[model samples]
Target chain A: MSAFTRFTPLIQSLPSTIPFVGPEAIERQRGRAIAARIGANESGFGPAESVVQAMREAATGTWKYADPENHDLKQALATRLGVSAANIAIGEGIDGLLGQIVRLVIEPGMPVVTSFGAYPTFNYHVVGHGGRLVTVPYVGDREDLDGLLAAVKKENAPLVYFANPDNPMGSWWPAERIVEFAKALPETTLFILDEAYCETAPAEALPAIDAFIDMPNVVRTRTFSKAYGLAGSRVGYVVTTPGTAQAFDKIRNHFGMNRIGVAAAVAALADRDYLATVTARIAHSRERIAEIAQSNGLSPLVSATNFVAIDCGRDAVYARAIVDTLMSDHGIFIRMPGVAPLNRCIRVSTGPQAEMDLLEAALPNVLAKLAGGQ
Target chain B: MSAFTRFTPLIQSLPSTIPFVGPEAIERQRGRAIAARIGANESGFGPAESVVQAMREAATGTWKYADPENHDLKQALATRLGVSAANIAIGEGIDGLLGQIVRLVIEPGMPVVTSFGAYPTFNYHVVGHGGRLVTVPYVGDREDLDGLLAAVKKENAPLVYFANPDNPMGSWWPAERIVEFAKALPETTLFILDEAYCETAPAEALPAIDAFIDMPNVVRTRTFSKAYGLAGSRVGYVVTTPGTAQAFDKIRNHFGMNRIGVAAAVAALADRDYLATVTARIAHSRERIAEIAQSNGLSPLVSATNFVAIDCGRDAVYARAIVDTLMSDHGIFIRMPGVAPLNRCIRVSTGPQAEMDLLEAALPNVLAKLAGGQ
Candidate 1:
């Protein structure tokens, strides 16, 4: 149990933790294989066939380091987004970019504002860097923009995080409201407008690329992991002013990207037809999830993401029981929010029909078992 | 040029910079393609055919996020090293792990000790986290362990970095001396024993795993990027006390690893026979590089790495001229250290005879042109 005694006080104070226990960990612990892999918001539809081919082709170049400047990928993204390459900074994933953003702005004891039950990984980074968290409660199931703004102003917080088409709850505000919230924030505050699930959201839910392109304080993080169906590719980027985007170079691991992953991401981005097909499939799966939840007498929250949050109509205990039972008994892995109210809903990611079929079969029995326990 | 006005004072004080300019950047700036990419110390010999096949096979699973715990890879490493899984922590690469280790022990303005011009990327991370650097100059082209020990004590620095069979210089200490150096450091000081080139080093240059296994303050980093020839795969790990190893879980992007990259690494580890063959090839290439430098009247330093650093027998200007002329005129990419003393040498990575033939043909002309310039 001996540890290096001289770790920074902040690092020492933080707990050794993970934002979510992966399905692999659960399978190892329970001695069972997962039948339905829909817990972590990954697209079960997989990447385009062309992406796999690109990755395989790139594999031969595995002995060379990835381009430290990320030139080609940036140029490709800029062309796709109709922005200059200088306005984009790529990293391993949105999760990795979030960590870098936290490091850039959060000094010891600086205030960072976000929702109470927001992405735990962001909170973990904020705390690891000694930033004080100022939490705003979710108003209903959606992140409360007003509450977040109020907290930011009150604390004069330097940074804030807001995810559109949010995780865990699968709720979102429309484009205008989101733009309004970004514009209303103080110019001193750096707003991380995470659009991780934007591809799965209704078109009306997303703001135009130019809407906040000129706003230096607003950084929109997007990823190929979700709708592009290359979760394991580890490609994500931030759209911001050139100056703000350049700041990432000061601290990011310059040669840290995997070359094959970048190739896969580039190919995935080029395959627009495949993306459209996947989006349609995800929408259908979301509808199927809602139908299954409703049939089981659970209320499914209206969703803008590739997932649904079904209210079990009880407390966190009941929700917890259902989540555990589904995985343990049926090998159907799903998750719930970490805090109350939100914890009453279990989150399930949209997947292919086979996974959807597994979920359909498991939910009824899980509910029955949980009800029997109660 | 607009940016968030309220970034932390440390971030505001830091400049946006990249430690190394990628070959791609140089090519773009010069409007030329790299004909011989014997720069950045990357293995142009490429990864094993088996490893490449493994990556191709893993490409289809790019939809699934790599296991957060990295169980399979950890198990493979542990079994290979005759250690427990708890002794290992996996990361994107040694570069990524170095950043994490610096973050673990360094707070703003805290003293960090390393050999001057040892590793620029490590220095970049230390500065990014606001740590003050205390550098000891390299003695006789090998890191002066005694001088480093003195600086660590003088500053009471909590972190010290030492790379055996070091980069840029390709020099190393005997295994006994390295072990002695690790044992000599204050228990409060964390020693980063970087062994990124261990596979290329003679057995006498590396301590047995058990030598420092019980020391909570010692962390040994290894990478598949070197001898395994999987630099783009971006797989690296730290071997340390279980407690010290667990600290990474607190702050690492748990799901950051690319699936195919991990698969390549595990496969690379399993094929030791391929590694042995690659190691011999690298040694042969290194000798050829040294001979090439000698034939050009440059003094090639003795190398224990995949690259050779040749003394240009003048100053930084001469070294820089040779590097620039080689690239611009011959499309041969190579590099040199940034600081004085070391900058008198141009470093070249080992590659196939074709690249060596390019160097062998180009170096004489480039040297003659540099002599004419003077």
Candidate 2:
């Protein structure tokens, strides 16, 4: 394959590892319809009707570029969080924001710290920008705050990422411990406290918005993707000091946001009742997912967010077989962690009752087929 | 004003220079509404009714992330462009794609080349990634292709940008000349043939799709933002060799695209009649703008895009005064070139008849006020 010859050495050295293989690709590759569309942590409960209506209403103005400063969404977010608009920054989503954050802080050969099996997207950005990854293992299925802080200190790393109600394991740390971790980190270390799943997590699991309001080194990343069910709308924001938030303006694609998405986010923020109702639905669905996993002879990890991680009581291969078989035979789409022992579990997202019903019916037969194959 | 102390020296040294101050900012600053939003080069004609309907329908699924692979859109672009899917890369918009291109090829101190007053967003990306810009002056109000090629070779610059049916000046080279320039560049220099305005350009001015299909060193960027009237949709793509296109995956936000926007683009592509109708309308708007400029004692440059650049035949200050007065006094929004001598012109985006009428009525008043003030 003849390629552009003069790509920087860093780019030339990078591999094409997309953060997550979307379910659309899976359907294409496997040639199967996904009946239980509960993969990728997407909310099949869908966006609030009000938010959808807002997007539809904004559709006519699709000819106009979104505000480059993202003024309205930031204003709404600032009001909701009780911070000034200058203290917020918005982007395509957490994935895009993570990429920008990496670019802003990590120079070539710099070190970045995260849990070993955390969000692959962040790792991809780190390596893409030539930042070395200094990873610590998850402790008890939750991101090990002590381990992450220690790695940052040991490497004197300038950047660290931690997710509350984390992906894959659906685990979380207490608000106090999270605050402690943030306060303990060096001021030189720019901590990305990704609260993407915070809305679905228990109240105790989330630090108060004011906790890190004054912390210059701490930027808490949140998304409308999970609890608000606007994942594909691609609205995400970060909360930090005005100075740190302003840094995003220095490097962000200012005109990158889609107009309807911004309207959807602003509407999503305003529909607090809908947000509450959907999060309650999400919590109920999480319970349903855990119940289904437990009934299938698997030990489902306790989850604070909108998914349950089932330990299949075997190795990674067994978990992989279950994941593959469920998809191939039953078209029940779910995902697994990238690294073991995290990989000993398959992650299932909470969705509508119909999707849960499909998972409930399919898992037993797939597990039986797997056992018989041996 | 405290910031994360450990941001890279390059990041610390950078100022918060946003690419374009959004009209929203202007409204806030001037305390006035933008009655005619013809700045930003966004199409006021809007997307096809079918496309808008598609977005409205897709809004419910905003709960799901867009396909990371962008399979269907790539397939559609491939079929339309007579290239394999691997030869295409989709991004948020041209601005977003330009940022990625800069990241892929530029490192600190790398001399990136482009027309002196070409796209500021492109320059923003280059400087954001620490690439020093080596600008070639535009000759006769058009991007000087020959000068750009010369600078690319002289600087041994890995990257160069040239836009056809250009923004700010609305000037273009014929297809043969564009292809000749592309073919003439050294194989080591990666050239960005930005064809964002191709949909509105004369047929003879656009190179054949096959012109650089096999040229690994050349990538052409196009957007739905222009003549397609989907600027707020944030859909843009690049056409290049499969090898070169694959490079975007190495660093792109895999799930960055918004779902409804992709659906809208697909719908817009399918509705060929609407595209033709809108382009014709844009052509008419261009003529209207030209007539308006001529009546105001300004020289309007010939255009092959969705806008016209009116030569105010004055210095940058006078042009600045015209732009400001149009916005402040008449609620008319327009933009102008940033650098002299290109700054002698004011760029106006082609829009609906009502917007044109507003400009027709407002321009003489604003210009007369400027003349009287002097």
Error of 2 at A358 (Å): 0.6
Per-residue C-alpha lDDT of model 2 across residues B8-53, encoded as one tens digit per residue: 8899888988878899899999999999999888999989999999
Q: Superposing all C-alpha atoms, what RMSD in Å does each candidate have to the true structure?
A: 1.1, 1.0
Error of 1 at A294 (Å): 1.1
Q: Is model 2 an incorrect, acceptable, medium or high docking prediction?
A: high
Tens digits of per-residue lDDT for model 1, A105-217: 98889999999898998898898788999999998999999999999999999999989988779899999999999999999999999999999898888999999999999
Question: Per-candidate TM vs. native?
Answer: 0.99, 0.99
Q: How far is candidate 1 from the true structure (C-alpha RMSD, Å)?
A: 1.1
